[model samples]
Target: MGNISGAIVMTNLIQVGIDIGGTKMLTIAYQHSKIQARSQISTGKDFTAADAQTEIERFIHTLAAPPDGIGIAIPGLVDRAGVVIACDVLPNLVGWQPAIAFSSICPVKVVNDAQAALMKVVSELKPQTVAAVVMVGTGIGAAIYANGMVLSGANGWAGELGSIPIEGKTLDAQASGAAILAQLGIDANQSNALVGANDITALQSIERAGTSLGMGLAILINLLNPETIVLAGGTLQWRGYLAAAMQSTQRYSLPDLWASCRLEVSQHGGDLVGLGAASIAI
Candidate 1:
């Protein structure tokens, strides 16, 4: 596969991509040619930074030998050098550095979860189109890509659209999965009771959730001008729910910016971080 820069060839190496989110951990094993397979595990509250690292090492023991490069996608701030500054997804990694720790084990590259997702979009958009990614999972995130180059602002927090501060609260606080659950009168601990609990009720959940997403997308469209914005998350699986908000928000943004842009739910799968992590591992 090509490098994040579009033409840089990677070394002949087998790579592993690991995504550590607040609710789950996903791993993907891949060669430059294609993904071998993917795996996922629940990230109960007990899963921590060190535990996540141990999980990766054990996974490596089964695939490639030690000393192989690894890429990590975590929630929170990612510096230009791929160092995680802060993250709430894994409490064990709070202020715990990856370069100093994981690098000691093997050459490790770190990335913000959203940027990692965008990398997969960039890889998938190869040869012609540009891409933008909006991931609305437990929280919301977005990143822009043009010619395989990612646009990260000066503070290294570029893809963060969740904290735009809407009506005395951020979008994440008001409309995240947790927030959606809160609106449904569910407890914080029971937030994900619906991921696989799909039914007619889940369909209603989708439309209700889409209303919040539509409001958020309005802000996104006005700020970032791109050819296409792809939405990725379990929330988008209810296709009608996602499409509703996307179209609803269209009436609120600038004509020029909104005219050329298209809102789409990414079929690229949630393994994006794992896949893109492999792409940039070397």
Candidate 2:
């Protein structure tokens, strides 16, 4: 396996990270920031919590030895106790507790995927910096990091921006990859259709989705006034989405607030969720 030394500081040995997404799952074993093993698999539409556990277990079997700890990042609402509270992207994951299911494997921690993404960048932030990571993937989700700490709030549900109401429908219903794909009469796995789309209807649908996402960003800027907002996720691959989002964010946000906040795309090109989860395991 490929190794990247000193990318992340670790105090433990043989840590494992599993990132479960709507269409795929990625698992990696790390030995002090160096990869020891890795695997990627598709989690089809009907994939359930049990299926996830089975996949995790199977991947662990490939490692040279048992891991000291495991962390799972789910694209949904996870409680403080590392239990899946709710997950709209992977509906069957709701209520799934990986810690309990994998007690025999090692110590396990569960985290919201977007929050886990935030963790990947947390160590690099300047103290007292207000930042947020908004992930626009199968569905939209965000996590806030303020004043040198992640703003998890009372149930680890503070950043459910996707659920925010907008014109009677949730933001996710209007701006997520799934939403855009649905409008184009395609399936979640067919997101490639959005790339280089030249048709007027397809382009318009993408613009609307991007505008909706921008509105959501405006909400974060107007209320939190964060200094930096990092945008991440698979949907960002769409050609015109970012442009539309930038335009709408400027249009909807207060001029002073917008001027102070700098928007960034993640520079960590690897499996960020997996890396973040692995960091938590350490």
Compared with the true structure, all predictions reach lDDT values of 0.69, 0.83
What TM-score does candidate 2 get on C-alpha atoms? 0.92
Candidate 2, position 168, lDDT: 90
Most lDDT-accurate candidate: 2
- Poorest 10 consecutive residues by lDDT, candidate 1: 1-10
Q: Tens digits of per-residue lDDT for model 2 on 99-156?
A: 9998997999999988888887766677668889998888889988877677888777
Models 1 onward score TM values of: 0.83, 0.92
User: Model 1: runs farther than 4 Å from truth?
Assistant: 1-4, 7-11, 126-130, 146-148, 187-206, 238-240
What is the C-alpha lDDT profile of model 1 across 124-212, one tens digit per residue? 56635556777777677777776556677777678777777766777776656656665667644444455446545544665666766
Name the lDDT value of residue 222 in candidate 1.
78
Clashing pairs in 2: none
lDDT of 1: 0.69
Clashes of each: 0, 0
